[model samples]
Target: MPTHSVLIRDQALVTRLLQQYLHLLKTYPIITKSVTSAVLSALGNLLSQVLESKKKRKDGQSGKEVDVYGPLRFAVYGLVITGPLSHHFYHLLELLFPASAPFSLLKRLLLERLIFAPAFLLLFFAVMNTLEGKTHSDLQDKLKARYWPALKMNWKVWTPFQFININYVPVQYRVLFANLIALFWNAYLTSVRK
Candidate 1:
């Protein structure tokens, strides 16, 4: 029942949208990751705030500060650090261990889980502590207190996710996929660190 001109106009709109997306994918891959990371990080922090508020309320505490700074720090970290590092690391991972051969998925998964995850956890705590304006000893103490528990929790969540990520996701979409997963993961991370 749609007229010819209306159909053409709809098709043209879709084409334009696709073209813009492809252009971003081709030309601004890292920037796209930064934006995605920032948005998801903010979402995660929002969840963290809500969960913390609920916990406080349950404990008979009131007037908990809804710290906007936490989300802002998350956004900055995502924009400046995690986004670009993940974008490049996944590329290098694919380059070093192309996913075309037998057991490639297993190999990538193991390498990522074993090597990158632990290192990244340490870096994340260090960076977050620094962002909080904690001194070196304070940062070290925080790490000592929280690191292993967080790592254990990270493994609990990320193990299966990375299996799907390294095996099934295309290279171009891998960071976006990870960011999508990270919204929840970051919420978990934020809450755990508290």
Candidate 2:
């Protein structure tokens, strides 16, 4: 087989797969996004654990056993919370600020970064706390200790990305774009929660 022919075949295969995924998204938007979020969130937690293990080995410390439940918790959170919330949130943004509106881009960015980002972080901490079986006091303590720092970090990291995502990405693909970025964001979140 010619090399060019093989390359074309591979591209065709990829195109077909993408088409199938888009069809699934159109048919079952929430479910598709939920499953995608679950898988990516789990992977993010696993990546964080792997990096931590490597760091431990480098520091001459005994490696801790991977917490098998960590990824599971993230998967559940992604499915139950992140997917549904993001899907709707993006939709709401579009409704609130149509593309033709003046300053729509700035409006969406401000709403997302100023309001949604902080609220979402709090929700994440609270939900993860509950999932971990921690007490209300523990949740409060966590907020006091971590919320501001995390929010600050979120503003720094997600501001520009959110701007791009809201303004440029198509509505249908917004959740997927966010999820891809959240792969690294989730890892950072896991580290911060520790």
Kindly report which residue stretches of model 2 are placed more than 4 angstroms away from their true locations once superposed: 1-12
- TM-score of candidate 1 relative to the true fold: 0.86
How well is each residue in 1-194 modelled by candidate 1, as lDDT tens digits?
99999999999999998788668977999997887788888888888788888998999999478889988988988888888988998998888888776788888998899899999888888888889898999878878898999999888889999899877888888887888888888888888778
Give candidate 1 misplaced runs (Cα > 4 Å): 1-22
Model 2 lDDT per residue over 90-194, tens place: 999999999999999999999999999999999999999999999999999999999999999999999999999999999989999999999999989999988
Q: Residue 64 in candidate 2 has what lDDT?
A: 83
RMSD of 2: 2.0
Q: lDDT at 13 for candidate 1?
A: 100
Each prediction's Cα lDDT score?
0.86, 0.94
Clashes of each: 0, 0
